[model samples]
Target: MPLSLPERPIILTGDRPTGPLHLGHYVGSLRNRVALQSTHQQFLLLADAQALTDHMHDPAKVSRSILEIATDYLAVGIDPDSTTICLQSHLPALADLTLLYANVVTVARLERNPTIKDEIQARGFGRDIPAGFLCYPVAQAADITAFKATIVPVGEDQAPLIEQTNEIVRRINRQAGADVLPEAQALIPSVGRLPGIDGKAKMSKSQGNTIPLSATEDQIRDAVRRMFTDPLHIRAADPGRIEGNVVFTYLDAFDDDHAVVADLKDRYVSGGLGDSVVKKRLEDVLQAVVAPIRARRAALAHDPGHILEVIRRGTERARAITDTTQRDVRRALGLFTLH
Candidate 1:
């Protein structure tokens, strides 16, 4: 039910199969997952159940995106050998854990969770909030505690989920008289949130501002060209502000050439830097970053059997580990076990 010291720390992170992951995911968590696999024991969950919280109406979209999301993972170099790629719906333990955790965490606490509150407002759920939607924090605690994940990669906005998970950990341990769940630390990425191509603060598929991982060359170019820039800086001689400018932000995140980006920023601030010039630079940078991922995702898409097999193998492995955790939790909580 809880984590023990292993040779390497356990990290549990995943994406909901609501849509294809985009540049926001690439910079925020995908790159870090690639690097962490070698040194840490990682489990990448295909969170189809969690996807259902809001997407229950359109099951087809979620189903289609499962393969698409898995393809994106392999396309981005997440080795199955190093990282276990598991399906959330396949793990019964998580459902059991969620139910148990719900009994411990209060409704008022769930309502007060900032991340859930923001999402509720964003989705306009209001008083009509889906019970599952309101219970996302509990489900997330289950996901984290299921594998006894000690290191969870999350966005800064998601830090509260991790904090809530630890709170459940403490309460469960108090009842169980043992550490039945381990506290997870949020491992935030260095690069912050990538703005939408429209210059919105958040990039999202639902918002139609996302550039998907499978975006084509033309799509990539079109997105970069349409990127938001300083309206006042219409002329090449006029100074531009980088604060809300999406092109420079992309450059800052994607362009590895510091001196070049620095020069561009200085010129943009002072004057004489055209939006088109910086846009071209961003387009080029994005092309290089997304091209390889697109190609790999295409190749992976051809073999549905292979992707299924990988998910199958990893899910089977995860089932055993999670089953053990369930038994531990049930026994710890003093729940009667027929077995």
Candidate 2:
């Protein structure tokens, strides 16, 4: 008889526990996770090991941010009952799978990954890049295949990583002479990317441009006040350009009132709307979104013990799934000898 498949697809997605998640993260994946959890078996990973690929000097920071990322997950309405939040380092199976998958991929392939290249340039690590950081794509493949995840939600820039993962999956199955691992498809977000307050193409913690999900009202207001706008619009009478306007980009992503935002865009271009007016509107929209998240984070903060318990439970559950995958992999590769 053929095997039974799950009614709902399994989804694998996560963030590096290097810092608090930000507005960019919410727009990119968090909102989608909240909506998909009830309909799918979702596995949210706290990728501490991957974070260490770059931040090896500060292991303590990774430890601290595990709870921070989990709280953000819960604050954003990723219910523990519906979503299994797992820590990447706790699953030794993932490490083993990563090693197995790495054998199938060439150094040339890893070097050619666009996401990896962009990261190497951004971090200014020309020749001094860590080998673990360079091979993270394989580790990510392990994370996805271990859960047999059919769908992976990620940003547009990460689409290349998904492609690399599928390549490894195909190579491994062909080598093993069986379809042992499932291939995953990337579910790219509609609002694919969010720019930094400084008008950079991406918001990043290293750039110091992110507005954290747990930010206070004052912090939100301050970030908004400093947001980049058209530099040429010197006065209220001057026509403003919107080609690279970060404020308008943010408004398009966050503000729900389409007609109102459209009107604001028209007024700004035609020469009467001031930057302050647009910034205030963005500030209001962001505060409305983050206020409830902030409140929930505050409440969750009061009970660190509860947060740790949740992580422990999810870690145990994730380990069992990965253990099965590891056994299958070892057997397929003819490495499972009787002890």
Clashing pairs in 2: none
Residue 306 displacement (Å), model 2: 0.7
Q: Which regions of candidate 2 are displaced past 4 Å? A: 1-4, 337-339
Model 1: per-residue Cα lDDT over 1-339, one tens digit each: 344667899999999999899999999999999999999999999999999999999999999999889989999999999999999999999999999899998899999999999999999987999999999999999999889899999999999999999999899889988887788999988898999999998899999999998999999999988989998898999988989998988898999999999999999999998888898888899899999999888888899899989999999999998988889889988999986
Candidate 2: tens digits of C-alpha lDDT, residues 228-318: 9999998988999988899999999999999999999999999999999999999999999999999999999999999999999999999
**What TM-score does candidate 1 get on C-alpha atoms?**
0.98
Task: Supply candidate 2's per-residue lDDT for 172.
Answer: 74
Q: Per the 3 Å backbone cut-off, how many clashing residue pairs does candidate 2 have?
A: 0
- TM-score, structure 2 vs. true: 0.97
